[model samples]
Target: MTGTATLLHHDGTEEIPRFLGAPGAALFGCLHRPAGVARSLVVLCSSIGAEWKYNYRREVLLARRLAERGVAAVRFHYLGSGNSDDGSPDFAALVAQARQVEAWGRAESGATRVGYFGARFGALVAAAASADTDMPLTAWGAPGTGAGYFRELLRIERVGRLAEGSAAFAEAEEPRVRLARGEPADVVGYPLPPELYDSAQSLVFTELAGTAPRDVCLVEIGGDGSARRAAESLTERGLRVHASRLVEDRSWWLHDADWRPDETRQTVRNMIEETVDWFLTVLPT
Candidate 1:
């Protein structure tokens, strides 16, 4: 609800940057409008912390590619993350924000059909938000449960400490204790609020309410099979699920100094191509 300027791309698509939601809780986003009429709209939800930073370029590319194919896409930063407002939002709040973004994208583009495409932790948000809405969803490299993802953060912190010559493995639970004590802890340079930590521990994809959706496309990067069981669970619940795996380096987890975009060029291209193709088949024309 704040931006007013529109940036026109060479492809005749326009990128409109704006803030949505209430004044203090406004979320920053960019709307990629196609050259002419749009057939569908996609809300692109990003991962938190370093994943968000590393995948930022790919999300922009995905939006632009969708626009080129006559589809409108909206990419946004969750409240308290990225360019959005400064209030710490828990996992549930992030899910609500995703729903709000999808609604706003539909209204703003006048596109009757909408879909969600989320990466990493954002995949959890998309799955939770798509509940009962019957929208198509695509999750890339999603964890099976929030608790697992939270533990990974702690592992990363421990590794960092070890690399810095600090014997902190024995105190690996310090961050969890801090959160349990109603305090904030820093994880991989991002502040993790106690409320968010608590909510994350309770978020289980297989047990989420209203798990039904139009369909789901699960793309696993690095062939780790982390999302395989979750995809199978959705299938068991009678949801249409298509799952695939791609072997690639885990560039999303790398530090800025260690990340090299060229190495993952093929992976990014394949992901966007597959996502756009899948959306075309699942969403109403």
Candidate 2:
């Protein structure tokens, strides 16, 4: 499996479609529905800004592997990302949307158990969504804190300014810069709407939704120890959660410039194997 093109398979052990899921919504996704009997169904959650441009290929391979292993999987784009609808839906709405997809998966696939596989912001969304649904499920690479990622994104944006060689802008005494009568400002791309931005700005880790004995496998893709911290917090709350680093995921697929955007590799398979063992064996159903 490679890209969405590769996702358009209908043969046994291949991804299929159920366009009947959400009628008015315009999300782009593929369902690797079961050919024979399925043991479980999984919905994959992606990052904010998606990272879908770079990570979609990897997800395709992962979804296919899950399907091949008898776990029917659904990989879809959230609102405002990919072929999804306009940039209007907020984070909570996105969670509901995922649940909507999950409902469809259950109705159509007849899965005995349902689960989630998330990456980055998707992890946070998955956690929130699972908390809302009364489903016994598993989470992978779940993010407990949402606003923390936004702060890091702001830092990345600042560094991006420096990379463009704008010393005056970079060395400015403060972050906020007012309009100068003799100077000017350029908005290269302000495509993002304020609704999403404000929502992301105020997000925090909390037990707002319902609780389940979740089996969480934290995939740390960054050097930061936030994954560990999140695991500790969840455990303290009495949730069955554990954090583990896919040590080379960041080195190979995360960094910019060197990312081989459209290749299927063993890294994804390795990740699935580790998480499956944790979710299927160690974590309670």
Candidate 3:
């Protein structure tokens, strides 16, 4: 995990692709540094599974935009995903890794404040990690409860099982699969641990109250009553919450094959613009 950070030059920015601290399984990160002094440092955490893959371009675009606005950004693959080494994937550990990257961003860019922006599953991770700190947060399309999210995950896995056929069933006969209580051995192409699924099975949105940051801007890709209610609850819990229902209707995770890339790109731009506008209003200039 301890290797020299390679500085790669990009348009009007410096990109450093490095392996973060791991004894054997190093986490991969690509830090985007602004050409001038940065106003703040932000860490981008991606959702699990297909959302992460589909929305990667959007994340890169946002990082570039943030750099242009004097915000240093780092996009990292969480443990067991992307270029990162394979390790046990759990929600709690992902949160800790995000915090570690946040600290790294503060040190690398010499920024005073560190903020987090996470999408889907990463939104939960961002919320959990930044709760004790004074940092601002932007959470997009976060589930109101863990059970709901877990159900969706299982459904996805079932579809994958049907597609993969009898070979997948044979794999399911393994002893650990039976003991894991229906926790997926793998979701799509991602191998999931039983502990990760168990942790997610009990996730409730209200639990975020215990570990919320001072300010949060809750965003939903499509309007949902549950998301709005979660925002209201957060407000009552003493955290400043701004809830908005964004009109980006493309479901990056559940869309059909006929989905248009141009439409998705536009939706991503809309989300990014909304988030940047909110950050500009609250974050110190």
Q: Candidates' lDDT values, in order?
A: 0.80, 0.60, 0.74
Please provide, for model 3 over 1-285, each residue's C-alpha lDDT reduced to its tens digit, 9 standing for 90 to 100: 354655655556677777888556678887888888776877898988777887777788787778777788888998878988887767788878888787777777777877788887887787777777778888888887766876777677676676789887566544235427755465656666776767777777557544644778888767666568888788777788888876644565655766776335666678788787777666654
For 208-267, candidate 1 gives per-residue lDDT tens digits of 522664688888877677668877788878888888987855444454555566336776
User: Candidate 3: lDDT of 93?
Assistant: 87
Model 3's alpha-carbon lDDT is: 0.74
Q: Candidate 2: misplaced stretches above 4 Å?
A: 1-11, 18-24, 132-144, 167-190, 206-210, 249-255, 261-266, 282-285
Whichever of 1 and 3 has more lDDT, that candidate is 1
Order of quality (lDDT): 1, 3, 2
TM-score for each predicted model, relative to the true structure: 0.91, 0.78, 0.85
Q: Best by TM-score, which number?
A: 1
Q: Where is model 3 poorest over a 10-residue stretch in terms of lDDT?
A: 170-179
